[model samples]
Target: MDHRFVGTAELVETPSVAVVVDVMRAFTVAAWVFARGAEKIVLAGSLDEALAWKACRPDWMTLKDGPPAPGFDLVNSPGLLRSADLGGRTVVQKTTAGTVGALAVKEASLVLCAAFVVAEATAEALRTCESDSVTFVVTGEHGQAEEDLACAQYIARRSTEPETDAAEFLRRAARSRAATELEQGLRQGSHPDDGALCVELDRFPFAMVASLEGPLMVLRPCPTPSSTGAART
Candidate 1:
């Protein structure tokens, strides 16, 4: 298997398998939503698109950042979603990086949304699927989003080397620019424990796979293959 890393929407070329990662929040939030029993998450390219989609399906819930948009059931914050019970509910998610990056890679045979929370499971899934080449899309910036990049590297390493420990990678994520900002936000009570929430390595035991269903990029959880053993938390 060939493992490599790319960045954001513009830089990602179609690979055999693509793991779109947004560790600071996006994919982390997705993992939490899935764990909370969300049926699926529809990835939208823009806030307007998300709202329009939600309007068409009144039962579908919307998750996105506020201030710029008005009709969302939840913000793109993992801390707020910690206790949410989204049993069988479908969520339409629009984010600045994560969803955009995911929608850009629809050409790939397999597209998995990833974060440290689901890193090991993602790697195990890749191995089980027998993918030839996998690209990690760090959906923060081209090269500056160290938190996302660190997660990509960790997943890549885990996919290839089964026995690797995530301690060092977690350390790197903590020192990233995004992590620093979230820490400051935590102290100010702006985001409140969101940084701590984002870095909870192996918090979820399944990989979120993005499938193109007509015009929607819907995400569903792919539990780690049972034969690959349990994911560490």
Candidate 2:
């Protein structure tokens, strides 16, 4: 346990760490939640857990879930989060993949959210930080979604080769062959924009990493678009 980087699957060993990636949509939405400005987030592994949390603290949270059908108050759509008033509110999110992995690693010394959007920062943090192990957690369709794998690959590239063209690697990741392979793996299939949107880098900087406690997740300020240059930092 020298370093831990989370990917989509169970785990892997790196030069000084392990990476687990869930690139599809879980971490994607996490970036949004922070960008949109939520005071806090709570990750729930199951629908029942999410509901119970919501029930106990009705005023503190809203629910997010999804898939083939709409089953919760709000789905895992980042677009929806922007306009929602999550001020001083806690969001209890139950995803098909992300939350499950998050639930298992309640003891990650440094559990940061990993997605296409937060890939750069994750790499940077790892390069400078000191940890026994680094884990990359990918929240995808229960081991589906090649987007996360590609993101993992990109992260691997960055951690190993700081001089590599990060942008180009990300670009290649955006349209990876794994995307096609993972899609083909899905029998019923995934969402329409699952592949396209998952790979968009830095769409929002809000990086939501997990805490070493019950259900809580942390938010990190992501670099915003430069052209606009509106909000400072």
Candidate 3:
């Protein structure tokens, strides 16, 4: 299998499977929300789009950039989701990296949102789906965020090598520019707990796959496939 990595939305040609990683938050937050029982998540490319979604579906929780809006249930913070009751609820999410990258990959046959929380499951999905080539899209903050790149590299490595030192990878990613920024934000009393949650590796075991449901990019969780004991590369 051919595995490649690209920063931001730099993919020129689409691959059989596209794994989008946004470790600092985005995908990490989504995984946690799904684990907490969110029925579905809709990815919006911009804040305006997310608001439009909320306008149509008043029951859905909308999360955009900056602080949480007056009526919004939550912000794009992974730590906050841990305490939220999202059972059977639909969420509209718009982030700086993850959602933007997902929207940019219009040519992918399959799109999956990933973070360290669901890295193994994501890799197994690619293998189970018989994808010959996979592209890891590192949705870096603005330019290139180290946390996203680390998560992307980890997923790529896991696709070929089953045994991975996940702890070591998380440790390295925690020192990334994005992670550092979150840490600084925490110190400033801005989403203080989010920094820790964003770096929590392997927090969820299921992978979130994106499917086009009408005009929305709906994310649904899929159980990770068990190892088939076949040689993978």
Clashes of 3: 0
| Cα TM-score of candidate 2 | 0.71
Candidate 1's TM-score reads 0.92
> Model 3, residue 96: what's the lDDT?
75
Worst ten in a row by lDDT for model 2: 224-233
Per-residue CA lDDT of candidate 1, range 91-158, in tens? 99988788888987887899999999888888888888887788878888664588898889988888
How far does residue 174 in candidate 3 sit from its true spot (Å)? Answer: 0.6
TM-scores for candidates 1 onward, in order: 0.92, 0.71, 0.90
List candidate 3 stretches off by more than 4 Å.
Answer: 186-190, 227-233
lDDT of all predictions, in order shown?
0.83, 0.57, 0.77
Using lDDT as the measure, which candidate wins?
1
Q: Kindly indicate the candidate among 1 and 3 with the higher TM-score.
A: 1
Better model by lDDT: candidate 2 vs candidate 3: 3
Worst 10 residues of 3 by lDDT: 224-233
Ordered list by lDDT, greatest first: 1, 3, 2
C-alpha root-mean-square deviation, each candidate: 2.6, 5.2, 4.5
**Residue 10 displacement in candidate 2 (angstroms):** 3.2
Off by over 4 Å in 1: 9-12, 66-69, 186-190, 227-233
Q: What is the lDDT of residue 166 in candidate 3?
A: 74
Q: How well is each residue in 91-202 modelled by candidate 2, as lDDT tens digits?
A: 7777767767765665555555678767766666566556555555555654544566567667767766766665665665566554564345451234455555567764
